[model samples]
Target: MKTPPDRSGITFEVGAQLEARDRHKNWYTATIEKIDYDKERVLIHYRQWSRRHNEWFQWSSPYLRPLERVSLRRQGLNAPMFVSGSKVMACWTDCRFYPAKILRVNKDDSYTVRFFDGVVRTVKSTKLKPVDEVRT
Candidate 1:
């Protein structure tokens, strides 16, 4: 697996959701308003549906920070590749399906990806072979 690149010139689609952790280590979901990969952080716009207040209030998460990217080496030659915003299927060891977008392609052979539900994760290319070679 390879480490992901410094996330610059990367943009998330509107309405995209992202996962963020607070100082308390509590995880929450927020919508992406803007991104700054060079800074390794993103501005997340969040709102909570308050049943008690019967209204939605605007909120923001602290700059969502990313950890260092890592990579894994594969035995075979490189296969066809996909670009940012390309929709692809990711299979994890847990036998679950994660639909994600390519966020950054690292020099070390890892990909920083954003899942459909808006969680940013780094996956090794060795672990994530493309399901289809044909580009959509």
Candidate 2:
């Protein structure tokens, strides 16, 4: 691809951790595996995914975004953070965040959430982010 400057204004170097949107519209944590400056293509390896899932995308593709919480909040994607009965993105073992609903909060600040798949689990608050954090 003859890539142009990233429309998102992102300029991440190789090995930078970020988030990438998949074909299904889900955002998953990723790392910049390589960059072909001449071709303007970036090789990304999805966190927790095998090598086969790594992909090459045009540098300017909107499918890529910063994963830093501060950057996300600065983009106006912040909210009350987390609370009971709120919609959230819960991180699973696959390192992919999935949409879930908070059922309650534990004394230790952990949260009991029920994923859309009907699986329930108590996850640390650090492993979750508000669903609104993802700019549709």
Candidate 3:
């Protein structure tokens, strides 16, 4: 049996939920299977139900962010600015702002947003802006 590696500031523990960037810079969730301290990366097993052969695929991490469990941080001075299910605008990598809904509030104060087109993305609070709904 192999011993689990010591936890580092950037390295996550086994079974920790996280999101990592793909080749196209899209983020996807995965679980930490192993940690490589020497290489400063982690082995993540991402589940893909669409795949037939490789249902749980492993990927290395340096581009991974630990999933947040708390909604607010910073000692009550920095509570999350937005709540889940809130309508907001999110900034994409292309620098364009698109309408999205906050799916969840992360411990890091970021949010998982779903765009109008059904694309989901985890973005920082700074990249979000409140939207004023216009009743029809």
Candidate 4:
């Protein structure tokens, strides 16, 4: 199979779905509502669903994952594959998944990861999920 291209050349436009890392290392799937290339930032709108309340939220960030990296439109309907150094969402104790980069593969098959907020942790493979599923 062919490999995906680097995301360095990819550009964002209005209505593009992107995964963005927040200051707390949490990642959320959002749609680009506005782009400000001069400031290297974009405004994103996302939905928040809760038992008590459900609403649409807007946020802006500089760190974003490319559509190619976060999209689930692949050859099959199976889970997306990930490797060391891959960007993923790791489940936290608060029952939330945060944005993190897989640092290393442990002997037991677990992974050491560094969150975008500068926190590091070791987590089981099951506790990890793809950024693509953040929306669905």
The sequence of per-residue lDDT tens digits that candidate 4 reaches over residues 1-136 is: 2322335624556776766665577776666666655555556665352323212222232456655533434323334356788989998889799999998876554678998898999987779987775474
- TM-score versus the correct structure, for each prediction: 0.35, 0.48, 0.42, 0.38
At residue 119, candidate 1 shows an lDDT of: 84
Candidate 3's residue-wise lDDT over 1-136, tens digit each?
3433443433457777666665677666666666665555556666462333212222233566554432124233367899898999899989989999999988766799999999999998889988867756
Residue 126 in model 4: lDDT = 76
Using TM-score, give the best candidate's number. 2
Q: Give Cα-based local distance difference scores for all models.
A: 0.52, 0.80, 0.67, 0.63
* Best model number under lDDT: 2
- Give stretches of model 3 more than 4 Å off: 1-77, 134-136
Clashing pairs in 2: none
RMSD of 1: 16.5
**What lDDT score is found at residue 110 in candidate 3?**
77
Cα lDDT tens digits, model 2, 17-135, are: 87888778988889888888788888999999898999898887788887775455545444535779999999988989999999987756578999999999998778998777648
* Candidate 3 collision pairs: none
Candidate 2 residue 8 C-alpha distance from true site, Å: 6.4
